[model samples]
Target: ERHRDMRRASSSLLGLAPRLLSGPRLCSRPLPLLAFARASQQRSGDAALALGEIRVADATGSLGVMTPKQALALAAERKLHLVEVAPNASPPVWKLLATLPVVEKRPEPPKIEEM
Candidate 1:
Protein backbone atom coordinates (compact mmCIF):
# COMPACT_ATOMS: atom_id res chain seq x y z
CA GLU A 1 0.00 0.00 0.00
CA ARG A 2 2.87 2.40 0.93
CA HIS A 3 4.61 1.57 -2.35
CA ARG A 4 1.50 2.41 -4.35
CA ASP A 5 1.06 5.70 -2.48
CA MET A 6 4.72 6.57 -3.15
CA ARG A 7 4.27 5.87 -6.88
CA ARG A 8 1.20 8.15 -7.00
CA ALA A 9 3.10 10.94 -5.25
CA SER A 10 6.03 10.52 -7.64
CA SER A 11 3.70 10.68 -10.66
CA SER A 12 2.08 13.86 -9.30
CA LEU A 13 5.51 15.40 -8.81
CA LEU A 14 6.46 14.42 -12.36
CA GLY A 15 3.27 16.09 -13.67
CA LEU A 16 4.31 19.41 -12.06
CA ALA A 17 7.82 19.12 -13.60
CA PRO A 18 6.61 20.56 -16.97
CA ARG A 19 5.16 23.67 -15.31
CA LEU A 20 8.34 24.17 -13.20
CA LEU A 21 10.53 23.81 -16.27
CA SER A 22 8.33 26.27 -18.19
CA GLY A 23 10.03 29.05 -16.21
CA PRO A 24 8.32 32.26 -14.91
CA ARG A 25 4.99 33.02 -16.56
CA LEU A 26 4.33 36.77 -16.61
CA CYS A 27 1.42 37.75 -18.79
CA SER A 28 2.78 37.37 -22.38
CA ARG A 29 6.21 38.96 -21.89
CA PRO A 30 9.29 37.28 -20.43
CA LEU A 31 12.11 39.40 -19.04
CA PRO A 32 15.62 38.49 -20.25
CA LEU A 33 17.62 37.52 -17.17
CA LEU A 34 20.82 37.06 -19.21
CA ALA A 35 20.79 40.67 -20.42
CA PHE A 36 20.12 41.89 -16.91
CA ALA A 37 23.07 39.88 -15.57
CA ARG A 38 25.41 41.25 -18.27
CA ALA A 39 24.28 44.84 -17.66
CA SER A 40 24.77 44.51 -13.92
CA GLN A 41 28.33 43.19 -14.42
CA GLN A 42 29.20 45.99 -16.87
CA ARG A 43 32.04 48.25 -15.65
CA SER A 44 32.30 52.04 -15.79
CA GLY A 45 34.83 53.89 -17.99
CA ASP A 46 37.78 53.60 -15.61
CA ALA A 47 37.02 50.05 -14.55
CA ALA A 48 36.50 48.99 -18.17
CA LEU A 49 39.80 50.52 -19.21
CA ALA A 50 41.59 48.83 -16.31
CA LEU A 51 40.18 45.40 -17.23
CA GLY A 52 40.83 45.86 -20.98
CA GLU A 53 44.34 44.41 -20.68
CA ILE A 54 43.27 41.50 -18.45
CA ARG A 55 42.90 38.04 -20.00
CA VAL A 56 42.29 34.49 -18.82
CA ALA A 57 44.86 31.83 -19.71
CA ASP A 58 43.97 28.15 -19.71
CA ALA A 59 46.83 25.76 -18.83
CA THR A 60 46.21 22.16 -19.81
CA GLY A 61 49.32 20.19 -20.73
CA SER A 62 53.08 20.29 -20.11
CA LEU A 63 53.33 23.60 -21.97
CA GLY A 64 50.86 25.10 -19.52
CA VAL A 65 53.27 24.32 -16.66
CA MET A 66 55.92 26.73 -17.96
CA THR A 67 57.85 28.60 -15.27
CA PRO A 68 58.11 32.38 -15.26
CA LYS A 69 61.79 32.19 -16.23
CA GLN A 70 60.96 29.83 -19.12
CA ALA A 71 58.20 32.15 -20.29
CA LEU A 72 60.61 35.10 -20.12
CA ALA A 73 63.17 33.15 -22.14
CA LEU A 74 60.59 32.23 -24.80
CA ALA A 75 59.51 35.86 -25.08
CA ALA A 76 63.11 37.20 -25.11
CA GLU A 77 63.46 37.22 -28.93
CA ARG A 78 60.29 39.31 -29.23
CA LYS A 79 59.70 42.23 -26.88
CA LEU A 80 57.55 42.00 -23.80
CA HIS A 81 57.95 39.35 -21.13
CA LEU A 82 55.20 36.91 -20.17
CA VAL A 83 53.77 38.50 -17.06
CA GLU A 84 51.12 37.14 -14.78
CA VAL A 85 48.31 39.55 -15.57
CA ALA A 86 45.87 37.72 -13.26
CA PRO A 87 47.40 35.99 -10.28
CA ASN A 88 44.01 34.55 -9.30
CA ALA A 89 43.82 32.52 -12.49
CA SER A 90 45.11 28.93 -12.56
CA PRO A 91 47.47 29.93 -15.39
CA PRO A 92 47.69 33.65 -15.97
CA VAL A 93 47.88 35.13 -19.47
CA TRP A 94 50.96 37.03 -20.68
CA LYS A 95 50.50 40.38 -22.42
CA LEU A 96 52.66 40.86 -25.51
CA LEU A 97 53.30 44.46 -26.48
CA ALA A 98 52.48 45.54 -30.07
CA THR A 99 55.77 47.40 -30.16
CA LEU A 100 58.12 44.48 -29.55
CA PRO A 101 61.87 44.32 -30.37
CA VAL A 102 62.15 48.06 -29.76
CA VAL A 103 65.74 47.98 -30.99
CA GLU A 104 64.77 46.36 -34.30
CA LYS A 105 63.93 48.63 -37.26
CA ARG A 106 60.24 48.89 -38.10
CA PRO A 107 59.03 47.70 -41.49
CA GLU A 108 58.84 50.42 -44.18
CA PRO A 109 55.38 51.67 -45.14
CA PRO A 110 54.15 50.55 -48.56
CA LYS A 111 54.39 53.20 -51.31
CA ILE A 112 51.06 53.93 -53.05
CA GLU A 113 51.11 53.49 -56.86
CA GLU A 114 49.79 56.50 -58.82
CA MET A 115 47.18 55.60 -61.40
Candidate 2:
Protein backbone atom coordinates (compact mmCIF):
# COMPACT_ATOMS: atom_id res chain seq x y z
CA GLU A 1 0.00 0.00 0.00
CA ARG A 2 1.12 3.59 -0.59
CA HIS A 3 0.80 4.37 3.14
CA ARG A 4 3.01 1.41 4.15
CA ASP A 5 5.68 2.32 1.60
CA MET A 6 5.72 5.92 2.83
CA ARG A 7 6.09 4.74 6.44
CA ARG A 8 9.00 2.49 5.53
CA ALA A 9 10.70 5.30 3.61
CA SER A 10 10.31 7.73 6.52
CA SER A 11 11.49 5.17 9.08
CA SER A 12 14.57 4.28 7.08
CA LEU A 13 15.37 7.95 6.58
CA LEU A 14 15.20 8.44 10.37
CA GLY A 15 17.38 5.36 11.15
CA LEU A 16 14.45 3.34 12.51
CA ALA A 17 14.80 0.34 10.20
CA PRO A 18 15.64 -2.04 13.08
CA ARG A 19 12.48 -1.19 14.99
CA LEU A 20 10.36 -1.58 11.86
CA LEU A 21 11.71 -5.03 10.92
CA SER A 22 12.06 -6.31 14.49
CA GLY A 23 9.08 -7.26 16.64
CA PRO A 24 9.75 -5.09 19.71
CA ARG A 25 12.50 -2.98 21.27
CA LEU A 26 13.57 -3.07 24.91
CA CYS A 27 15.04 0.43 24.86
CA SER A 28 13.50 3.61 23.56
CA ARG A 29 13.80 4.50 19.90
CA PRO A 30 17.36 4.93 18.72
CA LEU A 31 18.81 8.32 17.85
CA PRO A 32 19.26 9.18 14.21
CA LEU A 33 22.43 7.75 12.62
CA LEU A 34 23.48 11.24 11.57
CA ALA A 35 23.48 12.34 15.23
CA PHE A 36 26.18 9.78 16.03
CA ALA A 37 28.08 10.43 12.82
CA ARG A 38 28.27 14.14 13.61
CA ALA A 39 29.45 13.68 17.23
CA SER A 40 33.16 13.82 18.05
CA GLN A 41 34.67 10.34 18.02
CA GLN A 42 37.32 9.09 20.45
CA ARG A 43 40.95 9.43 19.37
CA SER A 44 43.83 7.07 20.12
CA GLY A 45 47.60 6.92 20.58
CA ASP A 46 49.24 10.37 20.43
CA ALA A 47 45.83 11.99 20.63
CA ALA A 48 45.92 11.51 24.41
CA LEU A 49 48.75 14.01 24.48
CA ALA A 50 46.24 16.72 23.56
CA LEU A 51 43.90 16.03 26.47
CA GLY A 52 45.58 18.78 28.57
CA GLU A 53 45.95 17.73 32.25
CA ILE A 54 45.14 14.07 33.07
CA ARG A 55 45.22 11.67 35.99
CA VAL A 56 47.60 8.72 35.76
CA ALA A 57 46.66 5.34 37.23
CA ASP A 58 48.02 1.77 37.22
CA ALA A 59 47.38 -1.72 38.60
CA THR A 60 49.13 -0.84 41.86
CA GLY A 61 46.94 2.26 42.27
CA SER A 62 46.78 5.92 41.33
CA LEU A 63 50.20 7.18 40.34
CA GLY A 64 49.18 10.80 40.99
CA VAL A 65 48.16 13.44 38.43
CA MET A 66 50.11 15.59 36.01
CA THR A 67 49.81 17.56 32.80
CA PRO A 68 49.72 15.59 29.56
CA LYS A 69 53.15 16.82 28.56
CA GLN A 70 54.73 15.77 31.89
CA ALA A 71 52.78 12.51 31.92
CA LEU A 72 53.89 11.74 28.38
CA ALA A 73 57.49 12.45 29.31
CA LEU A 74 57.20 10.11 32.28
CA ALA A 75 55.53 7.49 30.15
CA ALA A 76 58.36 7.74 27.64
CA GLU A 77 60.94 7.40 30.39
CA ARG A 78 59.14 4.27 31.59
CA LYS A 79 58.91 2.88 28.03
CA LEU A 80 55.13 3.01 27.99
CA HIS A 81 52.40 4.79 26.03
CA LEU A 82 49.85 7.19 27.48
CA VAL A 83 46.43 5.72 26.78
CA GLU A 84 43.18 7.44 27.73
CA VAL A 85 41.25 4.95 29.85
CA ALA A 86 38.41 7.04 31.30
CA PRO A 87 37.68 10.21 29.36
CA ASN A 88 34.51 11.13 31.20
CA ALA A 89 36.23 11.84 34.49
CA SER A 90 36.83 15.41 35.73
CA PRO A 91 40.25 15.61 34.11
CA PRO A 92 40.15 12.21 32.39
CA VAL A 93 42.35 9.25 33.36
CA TRP A 94 45.32 7.95 31.42
CA LYS A 95 47.18 4.67 31.75
CA LEU A 96 50.59 3.44 30.83
CA LEU A 97 50.41 0.80 28.10
CA ALA A 98 53.28 -1.55 27.49
CA THR A 99 53.49 -3.49 24.27
CA LEU A 100 53.35 -7.28 24.56
CA PRO A 101 54.09 -9.98 21.99
CA VAL A 102 51.10 -11.84 20.58
CA VAL A 103 51.09 -15.64 20.60
CA GLU A 104 48.78 -17.81 18.51
CA LYS A 105 47.83 -21.31 19.69
CA ARG A 106 46.14 -23.81 17.42
CA PRO A 107 43.89 -26.62 18.61
CA GLU A 108 44.91 -30.24 18.04
CA PRO A 109 42.86 -32.50 15.74
CA PRO A 110 40.29 -34.81 17.38
CA LYS A 111 41.25 -38.52 17.67
CA ILE A 112 39.28 -41.05 15.55
CA GLU A 113 37.69 -44.15 17.27
CA GLU A 114 38.32 -47.49 15.56
CA MET A 115 35.34 -49.85 15.08
- Of the candidates shown, which would achieve the greatest lDDT relative to the real structure? 2
lDDT (Cα, 0-100) at 57 in candidate 1: 27
How large an RMSD does model 2 have? 9.3
Query: How well does candidate 2 score on lDDT at residue 36?
Result: 16
Give the per-residue lDDT digits (tens) of candidate 2, residues 37-89: 22144333577676777889765778887887888788789887666667788
Any residue pairs clashing in model 2, and if so which? none
TM-score of 2: 0.47
lDDT of 1 by residue, 1-115 (tens): 9955764576587664423333444763333343212334333222323332344222332334444554545446555444333334555444433332222357999999999
Name the best candidate (by TM-score): 2
lDDT of 2: 0.66
Estimate every model's Cα lDDT from 0 to 1. 0.41, 0.66
